[model samples]
Target: MLAKANRITSADDYRVIVRRGAKVAGAHTVSYLRSRESGTDARFGFIVSKKVGTAVRRNLVRRRLKAVCHEALGDGVCDVDVVVRALPSASAADWNEIRAEVLNALERRRARASIDAASQKGE
Candidate 1:
């Protein structure tokens, strides 16, 4: 489960992140990541729409995404807000696939951030 502090719950925050965050697309989900102040915890949000499936299936996908975010938090991601929007295919994707894709996207973000940091340092 995600701690309250680690979950994105405000409508405006979601709108901003979804609109302005860097996008990372996967086979089953699209993730938007935005940087926050370094002292803040990493926050996560999910959008599992009807296109994904019935309420039960949508909830299942949301739960899986949440668990993945929780696991990612344990891996030391912080100072970022990530909002994952489940694609229709996500309802059919197994947990392992979803996990792999989401993790890959997050890892890609880390790599990108590092390169950015290096570039800034070099300038």
Candidate 2:
């Protein structure tokens, strides 16, 4: 489990990230990332819908996602809020597969941010 400080717990917070954040989609997961100016730690939220499976499978997917995010984020302090939503396919995915997908989504988000920054600077 992620530390409380590093977890997004409010519905409003999730809504803000989902509405205003940059998004990256993988085969089994979609990630939304929003950078904040005031926060000191990166926060993460997971969404495993009922469409993914029953209670047991949903919990399993959430746990796996949390582990993946912990490993990927490590102790990085970026003031970013991340929401990772698992698709139906995620229920069948292995840990490595889920990890890879989440990591890839994050990488894609980073790449897009850099490109956007460069373009803004060029303007």
Candidate 3:
């Protein structure tokens, strides 16, 4: 579980991240990330819809996603707000599969950002 300070708790914050953040999609998950100017640590939110499964299955998927996020982004690697939405396919995925998808998403986000930065610099 993430500490209160590291969790994105407000609906408005989630909306902002979803609307304005850069996104990366993998086979079983999609992640949106928005960098904050002042924050030194990253914060995260997870969304597992009813479409994924029944309450028990949904909760299980949520827990797995949380653990993946905690492992992948909990370190002070970047100051960003991240919202990870699980796809229906996630219901059947294992921990290694979920972790790989999450990491791939983050890496794609980083690559896109660097490309954007380079373009802005006219490089």
Candidate 4:
């Protein structure tokens, strides 16, 4: 799990990121993110609501999400705050399935952002 400073906290922050951030959706989760100040460190947060299931189920979803985020973003992406929301299906999903979905989402998001940025600069 990431530290407090690394997590997106306030409602305002989440809203801002949702409005301006790049997003990638997976089968069991979605990651919304905004670039950070320094562009060298990455922060993360996970959300697993009661709608998912019991406390244990929610925790399991969060745990898997966290692990996937850590592995997917580890030192490769920089200076961003990412918020991951788990869907109900995630509560019972396997780790490898979750991991592949997450990694694919992150990769696709990165590729799209790169393309958009390049086009913006008229490259």
TM-score of each: 0.97, 0.86, 0.86, 0.80
Worst 10 residues of 3 by lDDT: 71-80
RMSD of each: 0.8, 2.1, 2.1, 2.3
| Candidate 1 accuracy as TM-score | 0.97
Report how far residue 72 has shifted in candidate 4, in Å. Answer: 2.7
lDDT of 2 by residue, 14-78 (tens): 99999999888888998999977654777899999999999999999999999988886673536
At residue 61, candidate 4 shows an lDDT of 81
Candidate 3: which pairs clash? none
Worst lDDT 10-window in candidate 4:
72-81
Which candidate ranks first by TM-score, i.e. highest?
1
Please identify which of the two predictions, 1 or 3, would achieve the higher lDDT against the true structure: 1
Which parts of model 1 are misplaced by more than 4 Å?
none
Q: Write the per-residue lDDT of candidate 1 for residues 1-123, one digit (tens) a residue.
A: 899999999999999999999999999999999999878999999999999999999999999999999999999998899999999999999999999988988898889989999999999
Q: Write the per-residue lDDT of candidate 3 for residues 7-121, one digit (tens) a residue.
A: 9999999999999998888889989999877546778899999999999989999999888778876544466788999999999998899889877777776677679789999
Winner on TM-score (1 vs 4): 1
Off by over 4 Å in 3: 113-123
lDDT of 2: 0.87
So what's the TM-score on candidate 4? 0.80
Q: What lDDT score belongs to each candidate, Candidate 1 first?
A: 0.94, 0.87, 0.85, 0.76
Best by lDDT: 1
**Clashes within 3 Å, all models in order:** 0, 0, 0, 1
Worst 10 residues of 2 by lDDT: 72-81
